[model samples]
Target: MNKLKRRSDMLSKRNVIIPLIALASLMCCFQLARDLVDVEKNLDYCVTQAGKTLAQINRDSVFPRDIEKDGKRWNFVRKEEWTSGFWPGILWYLYEYTGDAKWKIQADRFTGYLNPLTRRPAVDHDLGFQVFCSFGNGYRLSHDPGYKKAILRSADTLATLFNPKVGTILSWPFMIKKEKWPHNTIADNMMNLELLFWASKNGGSKSLYDIAVKHAETTMKNHFRADYSAYHVVLYDAASGKKIRGITYQGYSDESMWARGQAWTIYGYTVTYRETRDSRFLDFAQKLADVYIKRLPADLIPFWDFDDPEHGLKDASAAAITASALIELSTFVPDRTKAAQYFKLAGQMISELSSRHYQSRDSNSAFLLHTTGNKPANSGLDCSITYADYYYLESLIRLKRLAVNQTIYDYLR
Candidate 1:
């Protein structure tokens, strides 16, 4: 009987092995054969607009005195949040499309500017955003060690802020007694993990990766409610793994879903799943995506907050971020039926934005209108933002790439 059972188990394993091997082979094919979208007009618009935007950031005003040790490069003007990375990230993406040496030059200049800053080794949680998209992408494309080192150093700096007691990274240096940020915000910590993932692939230290994963897991337990709509801030006892209280910093009360915050959670979880390949993370990602899509109107653009009290202008940033996340999530899903749905959803959002939301312009208003930066707090209301423009263009580029490469995205909506 034992021999028969062993023989049956061996047969079952052999039966499934070839199909798994074939699936692995398919993934390798896509990894090697990257199809790039050749949207010449839109590509030109994005590159030119990013250039124009960076040109406006006055070196003196945007950079402090002696940021670069050699009396060269731009300096960090203030305790800028992720603002420092926007230009380089845009430049790197521009290079991805145009292969322009000028953009590379500008990116190098921006890298130089990062040398002397208030957040050299990044003091705040926004450090991930500050470098991940820019330097992280830079190192990947250019094979530059300096860019890699800068990113690695930033991770080291970020790891310092990890509080073992809370199992999360504390953002902000006691900004508010009642609300000492990242200590309060799951969203803030979520944004930083992308860098850790990048570092892990590049042979950077594991400490950063461990810290980020720990925080992500901690945030998962604390912020997400039963319905899966995540909270904006989760207060925890720093010394003990205890839930002190939670607040809806920008959401409607404790339960109301803030559109941008939801978008953030969606994007963050997408990255989380991308790094870990954990089905639980994927489940979280899909749930957030479902909530986002259900709330979408005919236009596919989302309101600033799903539970907005006042009918305000649409927030293009939240929609753009969500579109990007959907694109990323679609790549990981093995099922074609689900992949096509998300692809169509992302396509719908991008199509609407490209055709009407904003023209492929090169001037200041490169991106679409209706972006509310923290509308729940009434900040940057109804104003164009640089990061929105950058990411919007990035989403298009990624979509365009998928279209170019005859990948699953090519067949998706």
Candidate 2:
């Protein structure tokens, strides 16, 4: 009789536990559904705002780079500018999101202004920024033969800057004369390697791929400190190809972790790993990402310099870049727990960025605000920069795709 009573008690407990588990799972599915709906709504808002901004800038015949401190006037630049590609890239992202013909039209128009770059000599490492972001996305979406030609030519131009001895591309040609840097390569240069990697596989010289891999490997060996935090610039001996020193041009100090520089490292290595299938770059990317994640403020947005939290200024651009990288990085991670963690953190960043706290909304035509561009030089401080908007839209697209079990690279196909 006692055994029967105990069995009945156990069965009763099991019945209650089963229903609770089912209820919890149902709630989780409901929350996920709600989150996806919110993502779509946010994307709708971004597309509308981007259209308005594009219309405003269309009258000027120049790419919009950032808003002034007053937030009334825009800072526009010519196609030769490093930031010129982001405006078109933003349009490309919008077109990808909505499959709208109007965005493709605008993207094509703006991207055309950069065709001259294909024929010109390498001005700096920014050929990738000035060309790839514009024509690369253009080619990806429309598969235009002209765009492919331009990309290949631009990749060849970019390769001109890579010194075989240094095993990395020279970042600032003008800086060599002005700053006395014999061979300076900055963390920002990592983002440009994609153009070479893509070009090599797509009918360009195989040397393009070799240059990119060497650059990644060289940067990995010299750009980082023991903690995996990257320096803004690493000076190499031009003749010997030896690292001279790691220094800072944009961070608060030579030792400080520059938010954008670290963000670039995370995004760049993620791309490198994707392109090369290199486990080393993948591991390095995760380490860099982990350090950045560990040092983030409570809001998930990093300060312009990780060491200067008391400055109280946030780099929304850095957060946006990291968020986009993290989402894509999550897809490549083999461990499910780590992948989920990365995805969740990326979602949190997107949520924070989409909130009124970061969105430019009524302040300006730009998507997000409070980016600290070249804070050390006092340029573009606390402003709405173009790349911030570009990556924010990108993160949203990545998140939306992943929510549907699709990879962010699905668009490449």
Candidate 3:
């Protein structure tokens, strides 16, 4: 009887404290609500803009590159580019949101364009990014048998890149000129592991699942610092499974934290915890989340590299990816206080991206605004990119799902 009375007292205290906390945050909460209205309006504009963009591309009778250039020019990229899947993935999200049959038709057509690539398996480690994002979303929404076969076959090809000795997939078989990184694995590879996990349970080889788990474990052991910031690359000795060194190809320096790479780690481990339900993965994700949150500016958008002295540019793609991951992360966090914090941070990121960061004036551009691609390489800096738009649409859909008390993973089911 005493224990029951104490529990009741604790519940009562929580009830009072929760409302007081909400009251304290009333202004911020009101601003967030206002931002959500803008999100809805922007999404409606995105659907129409995307439809027009697709129509123009189809009418041109040419394949499209991953980005929409200024003055309404679009480039065509080959199937081998790491960014190829993002275009179809955007169509899938548009279809998901608007429930418009035209978007569905466009998604099917665009997804079909990549179907032939699955038949000619290449050494590229980005098959997950190029195949899974398109076909995985397709199968989830449409249940098309053709999309399922494509994803499973793509998984088979991706498995061939795994080096059993190194316990991870080789990110690049070749290196830049004058550089020799033979057994290099990159943080971006973590995003690809989810496809392997999905393939294992959905009809592909079960070994794919094991390969993904091992890769993740190996990355966890080597890819992060004490602060939980991720290195862009970790070189390993293929013959001995020994560590070579951690380095950066796209970050400002070898020691600098690449913003997008950190986003990949956050999203990857959240998916890992979803697939395996491992407490270690969840705990690691939380730690990484805190590290990322601490590094953000007042707007919650991150620069291209966290350690760069000049804050001249921001990567909206990184912000979008991180926000989407946090939505899922909030659902898994066991601590109510931390869960609320994660959710609030996610809202802040989406709102910031939607408000001043997005390209509000450009109705002709199919891409989102303010994305920095490879600032270290001095290429595509502060330009709109396909993956940026893809993840932004994905994040918006995730927030919409949360509003309805649904999880993003439910779409996969």
Candidate 4:
């Protein structure tokens, strides 16, 4: 009788504490949900504006008729470019949420435009970016056979990029300045590995998995820097398995730091960490994140080049990439405080981009502005780039998906 009375008293205390905790958690969730709504509104606005821009691009009469590149049905667009896929990823997202027929039609048209490229196979490192993220994601969403076939074909092409002699993957086999760039870039190849893993599982390509692992092991050894920031390019003797050289390239150009590269390392190694569960990859991700967080500005925006004269100052793409990385990283780390910080930064940057950089006034070009493409290359400086749009939407979609389900890491682990 005394034991029963004590149990009842404990239960009464538990009820009080549980309710209080629930109330606090509920309030916190409400604030997060409300903030997510505001940010999503901004996303919708940007999406609509981007659609208008592309629609204008579709209608040739609005642009300067004399200009060949900007014409309606212009060769520059309504087509695929790496993961941009002529906005197929964006259209797919619209179709997924709104069931809009027009978006479906556009996505189908994009698939048609991309289907031919799969036949010849892109001999470059970005075939996965060009086809897999677009077509593969489309296949997952719609279960369309054509998209699946296209993705497989792209994987086949990606396989060719893997030269066993080097035990590493090469991207941009196309010569820079007519000199074949021999260095195996860390980011580009890692980006392709997921597709390879998919290929190994989907089609039973055992060698492909082995090849990817070898490349990853080599990358972990060669690409990582002392600060865990990672080298942009590391040259290896294709025959000797020795790292021949390393360069900063678009980084500080003296091996300083590149913000997007940092983001890429965080995402890439986290991915590798998932594949291998090697503490090294996870550790690398954490270290790069540390360097990244230390440099982020109040707006959560990073500069074009980290370690540049103005690091963490002017780049939206870096923020977008980092956001994507952090979302992925949060799942791998046991403690998600850092992940939450990165996610918050991503949210803040999304707001910041909408308020300042997103093209509210322009109705003819899709996507928010202020994307720096190949900042080190001096290409598309401060112009809207397609990959930025793709990744930004991807991050949001990731959030929307994860809200209902456990993270990728949950299943992965």
Candidate 5:
């Protein structure tokens, strides 16, 4: 009876072990094939696209905010918009990627557009988007003191918007005439805190860092739902600095999860943790990422607003931003499995975005990707935005660095 049982067990082991070994071998081969896939060709195409974009921008001598094509011609933004710095930042990254002197020259020229912005006091919370993305990348690449000075000055300008009583940065000034609530803080302001943190670490005032931390803490307390979704804006009483209520300026509702708002929070908290090494910020980022991952579609991209059941349109900008943030967040997450999962999810989003439906075919626009920006507002719907292309290229560079066993830099700082 014992011998019969032993034989039966041995047969079972043989059946399982053989298949397991074959499966492992196949997985290894599959991974090896994926690893061997040449990314340089993809980079070449992106570089060529970028070159075309540069030529068009130069030919027109315009700063692109977003693009609109009427089939006959393409219309682009020329004002010093919030996203103006992204073009220069793209040029700097292209220079970094290809070692091209012309890209460097163009980067400098494009970066000059935001220099005036840094000197003046910022009227809105987007100084970081304008100054840091351009001069920050410039300083990172060239270590130019001029760029550093501009960034520091911009940080100083940004600090003026901080409200001590509210414990947050004022995102927008009073827009309505004799409005009851004059102070508004938005989720997007979270992305700007890095400018303050960067200034503190780089010989600017320590108060800037304190203001950033306070703003993050306040936003974490007020802006997020129990499920980690964020509100578009939180209005406050200007004189007393008391919280009025959460509102939706760019989302479907105050209760809805605005895709870009969530992306900004994830990126902001991850960066706050990176700068401060605070485990609390890491925990905050992880919770938000978990919610985002759980809610994402099979394609790993998200709709414009997670709660907008009727108008569930894709926001490529949000996906690109989230993926870039996730890749960075993966580096800091201590749980190995979770980190791997984050990276894999980011890779999935990148793969989907790289497809023809998203990638620019003819490079007619001064941008690289087609994205849904402010869909509810009917602005730049299914068009190419400069910041979307910036983050897409940024994420690609990060993935390439990982593939080549190189360390990725926090270039935004």
Candidate 6:
């Protein structure tokens, strides 16, 4: 009789536990559905604001770069400027989101301004920034033959800066004389490698792929310290490829972690891993990302420098860039627990950035504010930068795609 009673009680408990589990799962699904709806709404808002910024900048017939805080005016740049591609890249993203013809028209026009860059000599490492962000996205969306040709040409030109002995591309030819860096490679150069990687597979030389891998390997070796916090600049011996010193040109100090520079490594190594599927890059990227996440403030946004004593200034651009990279990195990591953590962190960052605290809203036409371009030089501090807007939209798109079980690489061929 006691056994029968115990069996009955056990069955009852199982019944109750199963229902509770089902309810919890149902609630999780409901929350995810709501979050995805919010993502769509936020993307819609972005489309509206980006359209307004486009109209305002179109009047000046130039690409939007950053805002002048003193006058609260937009700063426009010509096509040759390093930042010129982000404006068109934003337009391309908007068109991809809305499938609207107007954005495509403007994106095409703005991207065409960069065609001249294909014929010019490789001025610096920024050719990837100037050509790939604009023409690369254009090719992805439209598959335009002209865009492909330009990307191939620009990739070849960018290769000219690579010295085989240094195992990395020279970041600033101009800075060599001005700063006495025999061969300098910055963390920012990691971003330019994507153009070379894409070009290598799409009608360009295979040497481009090798160059990119070599640069990434070299940067991974020399740019990061024991804690995986990256230095902004690492000077190398041009002839022997020896790392002379790692210093900071833009951070608060030589040893402090620059927010954007570290963000670039997170994003850059994520891309390198994706392109090569190398476990070394993947593991390194996770380490870099983990340190950045562990050190971020409660809101998931970072100060201009992680080691800054004051922590007075926040950088929305760095937050946006990190969020975008984290979302993509989450997809690549093999461990489910780590992946969930990364995705959750990225979602938190997106939530914070979407709030009025970061969004420009009525204050400016730019998507987000409080980006620090160069705090050391006292330039573009607390400003709305074009790259901030570009990457914020990108993160939104990536988040939305992930909600639908789509990968961030869905758009890429």
Give TM per candidate: 0.81, 0.90, 0.88, 0.80, 0.87, 0.91
Candidate 1 vs candidate 4: the lDDT winner is: 1
How well is each residue in 1-413 modelled by candidate 2, as lDDT tens digits? 11111112322432222123322332334345347337777788888788778767755348999996558657888888889999999888888777878888999999998888789998899999988888998998899999999999999999999999999999999999998879999999999999999999889999999999999999999999999999999999999998989999999999999999999999999999988877899899999999999988899999999998586788999999998998778767766567667777887888888888998888878889899998878999899999999999888876666454344554242
How far residue 339's Cα lies from its native spot in candidate 3, in Å, is 1.1
Q: Give the range of the ten consecutive residues with the poorest summed lDDT in model 3.
A: 1-10
RMSD after Cα superposition, model 6:
10.4
TM-score of 4: 0.80
lDDT of 3 by residue, 1-413 (tens): 11111112332432222233422333234356445546566677778767666766744223454343344655657666778888888888888777777778888887888887788855678889988888998998899998899889988998988999999998887662237676889999999998899999889898999999999999999999989999999999889999989999899899888999999999999999878878899999999889999989998999989999998888888998998898777767777677667777887887777774465346345556677788767777766778877887787777665444344465343
Ten-residue stretch with the least lDDT total in model 1: 63-72
Better of 3 and 5 by lDDT: 3
Whole-model Cα lDDT per candidate? 0.64, 0.84, 0.78, 0.60, 0.76, 0.84
Where in model 6 is the C-alpha error above 4 Å?
1-37, 58-61
> In model 4, where is the ten-residue run with the lowest total lDDT?
60-69
**lDDT by residue for model 6 (1-413), tens:** 11111112322432222123322332334355346337877888888887777767645348888985533567888887899899899888888777778889999999998889899998899899888889998998899999999999999999999999999999999888897778999999999999999999889999999999999999999999999999999999999999999999999999999999999999999999978888899999999999999899998889999999999989999999998998778777766667667777887888888888888887878888888999999999989999988999998887665454344654343
Q: Any runs in candidate 4 off by more than 4 Å, and if so which?
A: 1-39, 59-86, 275-279, 310-313, 357-364, 406-413
- Model 1, position 68: C-alpha lDDT score: 14
Q: For model 4, which pairs clash?
A: 50-366, 53-364, 53-365, 82-130, 303-312
